[model samples]
Target: MADVHELQSLLGSGEELTIVCHNNPDPDCLASALALGRLAAAAGIDERRILYSGEITHQQNRAFVNLLDVELKPFDPELVVDRSERSLLAFVDHSVPGANNAVPEGTAVDIVIDHHPAEDVQARYVDHREGAGATATILAEYVRDAGLDVDATLATALLFAIRRETLGFLRGVTAAEYEAGGFLHGHANDDLLAKLSTPSVSGATVDAIADAIDNRSVTGSVLLTHVGRTSERDALPQAADYLVTLEGVQTAIVFGIIEDTIQLSGRSTDARINVGTVLNEAFGDVGSAGGHREMAGGEIPLGIFADYTSDDDQLVAIVEQVVRARLLAELKLSEEDGGE
Candidate 1:
């Protein structure tokens, strides 16, 4: 549970508040930042800003920000330095300072309100509830208890964050999520929700999905596919999500060469396998990756093969072979069991 009064006290004490969102934020992180901003506003913090480390690559995320007119700034190192007596920095959705975000490891954190599983959190006021389906669900509790009038924009964002994080109340749905959804449902704008749910799917995304479908390999119940190159990093997760629904397939791994790195996304419905652990075991030494048991994503620098090749086609081919072999070995599937 969140220390509501302490959060308010921390906000009130600070002249300026910086709410930091995790890198490549999804709806849950963005909504949590917005809700925290509202709390800061109510607490008399005049200068409050939401900052994030990476690009908002997903279609729904871009739509969420534009349609709601959300004012977010890209994180800068200097923003961490302020001359004010009481400068507060809060982290939402992600806990570790330098792990998933650009914030330095030793930077002081005034408050942390999150739903992700974490440990050794060193914030003055911490509310890290892994039980909550979405961090927005925890924020909704504070907003309701504070007796603030929930605006339509915030309500819609919060409600959608909860729904999207839990996959429309189908996965990881808890009682708190249902309560949060119920609280925001009446105040949420149905039209805006409809628009946010169905944004303009990019041509790049369609092409990536087509590539994933065209080039797929299977081993036992595990499926792996790589989209050679794409400008859209978010397409990897969408492709993985689609592949998981294939009959007889319990796990799906979708990877692509985006920019200079290999972006990998995985989804698993197998009770015996934890996709997050498997992904980390497969690629954590060479890159950064981790997530829940059911879904995971990672990025590996192309520098691993920088001296080996320069051609785009050749680079992708190397990544495909390496990624497939690594995941297969991690999954404990024999080479003979693997087939396209």
Candidate 2:
């Protein structure tokens, strides 16, 4: 368990605070960042800036931001962060410099509070509880322990984040999450959560899911699909979630092209397979990838690989071939086990 007083003491030493959310901020990270902002304010840090990298293309994420009025700035590469005593940099939900974030490599980080699996995290105060389902659970622990008054908006964000991260207490849920949910239940607005649960779905997301269904292939107990190209990277995870329910499929991986990067989202029901470890083994050397046992994602850049063809179809084919081969090989699936 992390010491909330120690976190408060660390914040008290800083004059300014900057909370950074990982690339493509989700409810978990957004709520965690917002809650951290509140903590920093409570710690006598007046000036605060919450920033996020990448696109907020997810519909539910958009709803959460608009409804909760969670203020955040888009990460600007040209913006220079003052590293003097006036500034303190903190990361929420993600615990690294460049990995899964637009923050430059080797950048100084003061605080890191996250629930994901991480390695070589460099921060002055790091509270990485991998056992917790959501980073919000950890933040809730602080909020509950420190006796910081949580308003309805903040409470709703935290509660919604916990639910989303744990898939409604179905996946990756822990005791901390349940405890946090119970505490937040009184404060969180049920009406807001209902609205957040059913946000407008983009046509692009539906199209991507359709494409994934058309392109799916099964190898042993695993299903792999490529959606060709997509503007909504978050749709990959949704498609993965949908595909994982396919009959006889124990695991599902959905991938697609987003500009020059090949992005992937995977889910697994098989106890034998740790989706995060499988993804790291398959793609970590080529790009960046990892997550919990039930959920995983990867982003691989197409540098030399994109030069294989001028046509988009050819590029998709190449990516499909490479991704399929790599993942199946890592899973030790034989060609004889392949199916459509």
Candidate 3:
């Protein structure tokens, strides 16, 4: 449990509070923010004044926010503004200051609650647990232990976050996570959970999947696919998961340029391969990358993609070659010998 006294003190001090999530906020990020905001409001804080960053991009995430009636004021990333001295900032789901879902540099953060690896933080209060499936799981504990009442909508929001971010508890989950999940499950709206879990399929998603399948190439046990450009960032991970189901395909790499960034999503069923390491080796020099052992994602800037566009096919071929090289290294296959 977090320090209730500290939270109480912040509330008593009457500080302006802002809650920020990472760019492209997912279900966990949005739901956790909503839960925290609800708690604060119940304790006499004004819900209308709280500021939130990022636009809801994923369909289910948008639905969760709408269903919960979570009120959030818009925040601008490009605007130069002062971080209120009396303002308290609480970051959820991430720790690093410049991480994908982090407050911009020079902004003071007062609290951080996360399930990712700990990083340097200026926040006075920090509770980080990588073992938890999602930050929403930890936040749910705070709500339940506070003996505060969460409405059915808020309950469903948290439940959806836990399920979506954990991939139905198949990734980065622990025993305590299940306990928290069970608690939320008891009170969460089953109908809303079902609807959010399976959002209506979009035609663009189908087109993207077809493009991925048509462009897929096999080299040894490595399956590589480049889908050129995409507006659906979330689909990259879905494509990665689908590609790994192919026979003899132990590792899968899906790459696509989205907006100004080139995204890479990698997945592996083999215990020997660390997709995180492969991601770091492949894009660490060019951009930022990180994740779990079996599933990892990375993003390189548009500059790198532009450089490769001189010969589009050659550039994709090079990416595949690099990924295969990393996979072969993981498999202990010599360059002279073919991949496993």
Question: What's the TM-score of each model vs. the native?
Answer: 0.95, 0.97, 0.85
C-alpha lDDT of residue 139 in model 3: 83
Please provide, for model 2 over 1-340, each residue's C-alpha lDDT reduced to its tens digit, 9 standing for 90 to 100: 8699999999999898888889999999999999999999999999998889888989999999999998989886544254676578999999999999988998889999998999998889999988889999999999888899988998999999999999999999988889999999999998999999999998988998999999888888899998997898988999998899899998999999999999999999999999999999999999999999999999999988788788999889988889989998899996688677
lDDT (Cα, 0-100) at 60 in candidate 2: 93
lDDT of 1 by residue, 1-340 (tens): 8668878887888888888898899999999999999999999988988999879989999999999988999998778755355878889998888867899888878888887666689888899987777899999999998888999999999999998888788766789999999999999999999999899999988999989989988889999998898888898889988998998888999999877788899998898998888988899899978777778888888886767877988988888889988998899897698566
lDDT per residue for candidate 3 within 1-340, as digits (tens), equals 5665566566556445567776667788878888777667766667324345545656676776676676666665432146545556778877666666535676656778888654476576778776677889888888887777877887888888888877888866777678878888878888888888777667777777777888887666777686766687767777888889898888888887676777888888778777777777667777877666677788777675566666656765665566556545655555554433
Clashes of 2: 0
Worst 10 residues of 2 by lDDT: 77-86
Q: Which is the winner by TM-score between candidate 1 and candidate 3?
A: 1
Candidate 3 lDDT trough over 10 residues, lowest sum: 76-85
Please list the C-alpha lDDT of all candidates, in the order they appear: 0.87, 0.91, 0.72
lDDT of 1 at 298: 86
Name every residue pair that clashes in candidate 2: none
Worst 10 residues of 1 by lDDT: 76-85
> What lDDT score goes with residue 152 in model 2?
97
